[model samples]
Target: MYSISFLIGFSLLAGFAVAASPDVETRSRRVRLSASVIALASVLLALFHLASGPEFFALSPGVLHVLDWMFTIGGVGLALVLLYFCRRIVAREWYIPVLVVLQTGLMLSAEFAEVTPEVAHPFYIDSFTVLMTLIVGVVGGLICIHAIRYMQDYHAHEKTVPNRQAAFYFMLFLFLASMFGIVFSNHLLWLFFFWEVTTLCSFWLIAYSGTDEAVRNGFRALGLNLIGGVSFAAAIAWLTFGPGLHTWELDQLIAAGSAMALIPAVLIAVAGLAKSAQLPFSSWLLGAMVAPTPVSALLHSSTMVKAGVFLLVKLSPVFYDTYAGLLLSLIGGVTFLVTSLVAVNQRNAKLVLAYSTIANLGLIVMCAGVGTAGAMWAAILLILFHAVAKALMFLAVGTTEHLIGSRDIEDMEGLVYRRPAMAAMMLVGILGMFLAPFGMLLSKYTSFQAFLSMDVMLGDGLMLATILAFGSAPTLFFWSKWMGKLVAMPRRLPPGTDPIPRDEAIALVSLTLITYVACALFPLADKVFVIPYTDYLGALGLIPVVAASIPWDNIAIMSLMLAGLFLMPLAFWLRPPRHAEVSGYLSGANVSGSASYRGAMGVERVVESRGYYLSGFIREDIMMRYGMLGAGVLIVVMVGGVAL
Candidate 1:
């Protein structure tokens, strides 16, 4: 029967296939098809888990044995190679459906056949694991498809650079496979192996352009992540030798409580902080923007950084109400507040996105540090909404950059008139990040309630609330500025064809619908996914589950507003609503109509306004220096508190 092993193995094997392909066209077709299949498999896996009980396929004794046999002895080697042969059009067309049908049959059989009693092993599967798999498979797949068209344009623009599309796709698929491994592995050693694989993949993809700056940034990323790797290794060593625990299973270690696990947990938390690009470790992600847009989307949203938070949230229970928890939460709080302010100073489109990504990650880290069931619930919601929304924003910006020939926020001032479809999609992405009646906003509201309910001894709830309130202001400022630029109208539309390629358009539209659907169905999501997971934690005595319920009344209101948000836009676009056009009114007489005004010396002056970035006061370099300093201190205190 199909299992998580197949999901991991197929993705790993697909990376090898894509890398070994003879040409660019073959590589593209194989990657797109492979990603689609992986996504389908992920959805089926999640559904099967839901249909069966929570304990369904929780663990089995001989799971790895099956994986070993499938990958060896020339059993499926020949068929795997034939699957990617682009010249055989008929074979390619037939192979996909056949594969899908077989997988579906296998999954159905496994579901109906008697499930064995649950057992413990290196691998673990649960609702959370499947939820993450869905995010990676679905979001990661769309990003891959979008990259197909974006890379072609990228190569055209960077004519002097050597083509390395095959290597790029190889790294992309390998990254996906590594993510599956990270989420599924319960053995700390096994998890470490996958964690390092993602780090290596990240370095390779970031340096694909082979430029001096790209190489430099890639090395910087490698060095910092290696520090994280070393920390993970040290934690494993401590768990095995220091505490005298022979087993490396994470659940067993957490069940040992804070007294036995605090030191190793703090070490692992340091690794998570670095991997997620928290304040002191954030330079690597910012520099990663030198890579293509897909790389940024993949790293920032679904795959790499998400792996970091997944680990941290898993380890949250161990640190609850300890001094370590207070210090760690402070690290995240400081990172969030500082980065949001720094983002306001950035004019480069990607830089702004990168800073915002780090800031939101900081918020997730803060929730994890709180270590209550309710806080973890808020953390997971933030991850889900942020992944979909951020992916949409990054991909939309990439398409807009290609059309306008610049990534500066000022250059996109009249995008709505020039490319209405792209602008509308971009607007949707922007709204998802900060506005009411959207998942991100609602997630933040949940986090606020979770914070209020916390009963931690060492942590000050009011202080955390203050940081959140102050930090959110700058988030609104930066996103609103960019949103305004996208919608601002010019006197006349520019004379050019801002055509979105089919692949890019499909990804953008799909993500937009996903963002809306997720917001619309959030109350149901909370019941189905969040509540159950938290209840399980409470039952295990891992966290204190307080009295929490989804705010149904607020959800109903948001639904009504959401309906208007989408329906009004569709109505305006569908119907012909004619309006009278008017010229701009200047205080003085209009010299050349709305374009120019008369000055004191009878000189013609152009009318214009610009965004207030506060670049002089809120400098990026200055803020980063101080932010890193503050976060570094907090991390030190967390480790010390735990050890002492």
Candidate 2:
């Protein structure tokens, strides 16, 4: 049943500040409590839906219909509230409350209405819907909790007036609700509306800092996503007017995936790539790092990027066997390989994560494009596992930045002593990202098998598959180096730093728990969620045979990981002589009373060692131009191939 009351509760939580005193402490406590309660209720709602099955629903025509209207009207109202907030209409402080009231009324109408499914079914639940609802409610809610403490520290440090905390939290909740609407909607038009809402939400969140760079990045993000929106709109129009593709329901569109389905399918795939931030479009995501940590976590982990992949998976049946499918796979593979290479050159921790996110997404997209049951299963599992690990890493990096005032991995060397808990948690998160037995690696392994099998059977080109395997090797190299640097031993702590914040510690611990639980549950999860999706794909003729002996056994891989894990501790215990280290080939006489040395002229100079950004080899400007050109070409190939 659609619980209007639950939506009301979240809306009320967002508006709690209006009724409370202006004191900071009271507002903080109220926000935290309200966020916690809303999260708990969301979890309960998710559980209820999962247990009750998708068919349990009220057939009311009154409240439920009203809720449907409210959803539409409230969307506009929220936009207005945001406009007012941004424009500084002090007289219209009431807009947020009015928006909440309208949304509540919409929920009430939807809940009480006994409308036919054909006319309007605002409240409904299925497995897929429930999954997304859980994510929005749980992950999004926790981020809200994090923001409460994070904003306090952020403002205190920035010393800004006209604190934007209230508006920020308000939009955060709206973002969550819009994400829920996106996945839950049966109608394509409604989903598109929600899709735009998410884009708007991202725009606001990215520019929340109100800095010039923040605003620039936000505009960049907006510009790129608008491309996705246009593609989405085109796809919808094609589906609506094209032969035998009239319905907007996902099930209907999938059911109609005949030989003629390729045209719209290609359009949809284009939109997916844009939204997912695949190679050419990835600059926006990199730019998005200018926003707050919570925004980054939400974008990377739970919402925007995932929507793109979700759409691809949902429409796999339509494009799998056609040239469109092959093209999609190729695009995904290229993005995956190139971005992983680009990630190698990044010193900024968040940029590394951002590129890595794009790279992993490319892998997932390629898997979906492979159009096999095994590949689809791999993609979904990757999505779930990557979300937890990536979110953990982002939050960890955010905490580190707050503590050390830097996100550069070079500067973060020997950070463990200063914030051991965060460092340890980050290690786990990174391990989940790279090493085997973890879900991301497991998915990658499965993907490799899927690609290999696809190539052998279908006679598809193996270029992409080979590139993917080759590209992935560097992933382990860079991640291991960075993780090692994080916990690298030093003689003593660096001077001038305070202890870590309690809220940050709590956030890290919670993220770790989630990541570990998700990893631990992978085996069981494979049985429940993955097996079914895989079986569905298998039935569609995409199953791949996984070879047992290729590179090494599980034990061999595990041993390597164990070795890396123990090496740091061993190094610390041994405390090898620091003076034993020799200079590089260009070494000169020591100078400046430190690591400095005399050059050719006997001049004192510092010996600087820096990691590669490889800008010359893969310059962003060059890459961006080429990436967009490639994406555009692919778009043409896909659409034309489908039309033909």
Candidate 3:
């Protein structure tokens, strides 16, 4: 009966060992082995903590004080570390360290003013905590496992960045360890400590290549997230000093949700928005694309950005009807619409994934702002589905890029005949993202229902719904185009020579299976995990109990719809011998063996067409400009409203 906390420490130690040894294949094996151990502990952690309320740990109050001092020092240490990493800009940007020192000062002040709370528990392992732990352990671990193969292929061509294998694995594993700590910690300051650890790890990884763009974007990420750290520190100070409040434990805050109002709560929510990259702050995540693919996948899917939405979801109760809540909904709605439009205007596949991640997270933020049990329910499911599907898509793109030397969606044309296995896997990810029966679309449908259930055309819910409707059509357009290209190869073409690496193939195939399995059993998943977490929120008086009536007929129809979406293309895939081989329309005589046609002067020409990016009509630069200005106005309004 090992504690998951202990097991995570063990994995961290093992990661250090692997990093010291300096071998990629061995590191891969050890990482997966550590992941397996974590996966098992996750199950056991769930078994032990089920409905077991607040089990106190054996620790003296004196040790707690020492722990507080450690984190205060830790905050300063992180500032120094960031300053070192971003040293090149320090001469020009003296305010960077100045702000960091200010944040550290606030944390130190909060540390001393905060008496050791009456409640001394360091951790809580509720069902939601358990769910988060599993995601970090499983999805995060899979990405790490996938990173093994990816980094190897990555270094093959990535000569600009000197090989830093040891540093990469160490940061990645440490990030996982910190994620476990973040999920379980009950004390607000302790949570902030782990939260900052994630920010630091991300900065290092994003700048791993050390190129001019990489380093610049790394600073962008660091500066914005440190703003979140400052906001988080201020929230702690306000909670410790403002009013009659005495404790920094989140559960206690929720218990007194009725008493807590805008000032401190809004501080915490603003930090979440920054971390989640909502609206005006989204440029960091877009800039994060300069990092390696696993870094992008890790931050977007399982860990960093997810942390932001998690905090907002946790604080959804405090956000129920205030102007702060209305503003959050507005930011999310606008972000979703703007990013979805921006996604269509990009040919870069990873950029498409980046924009899509921001868009989906905006939806999650909307759900949390809606602050109903059903909305939270959809928010949680989106977290789960997006993590896996996005991971799969990222890895697929990474593999495809290495094999073909391109990340453009148009280059992925004829992928079905060229890399059928990979094409099928990518299809699963794309379909899961937008089509029926799969978890993301199902969760979206639930979110729409939640929005409609609210006061339509009269409230924030209606405004959000309008954004959702406009945003969704572009999603179908872009995804359908990619899907069409993946299978567009003539029936008789032979497969490509580049085999997907063994480890990457394993990770991809496993995730594909999980996606289908999760879809098939989503009902059971809802019954076991989703319903209980929402019920817990109800018990806390945070939200009302949603109607328990199961939508069996809708479920049946959705199932039929998924079957059609899944089966029809697969049927076409199976019809090779019986399928007629036809060339793409050329409007005249075509070359027999290639995609070329005869010119009027009898010179051969290669005909090609690319997806319409609508570069002129729907420009990214213009969208970002207006989107940021609008979001900036809303934020100013929020602060003004709070001040008044």
The numbered model that scores best in lDDT is: 3
lDDT-based ranking: 3, 1, 2
Candidate 3, clashing residue pairs? none
423, model 2: CA deviation in Å? 1.5
Candidate 1 — number of clashing residue pairs?
A: 0
Clashes (N, CA, C under 3 Å) per candidate: 0, 21, 0
Q: Give all candidates' CA lDDT scores.
A: 0.77, 0.68, 0.78
Candidate 3 per-residue lDDT over residues 160-266, each given as its tens digit? 77888788888888888888878877788889888988988988898889898887787778778888888888888888777766677877776666356456667
Task: Sort the candidates on TM-score, descending order.
Answer: 3, 1, 2
Q: List residue ranges in candidate 2 displaced over 4 A.
A: 3-21, 45-130, 160-162, 258-261, 455-461, 490-493, 533-609, 615-617
User: Model 3 Cα RMSD, Å?
Assistant: 2.6
- Higher TM-score: candidate 2 or 3? 3
TM-score of each: 0.87, 0.82, 0.94
Q: Which lDDT tens digits does candidate 1 get at residues 159-271?
A: 97799888788789889988998888876655776787787788778877888788667766765765676667667666655644444677777776677888888999998
Backbone clash total for model 3 is 0
What C-alpha lDDT does candidate 1 achieve relative to the native structure?
A: 0.77
lDDT, model 1, position 19: 83
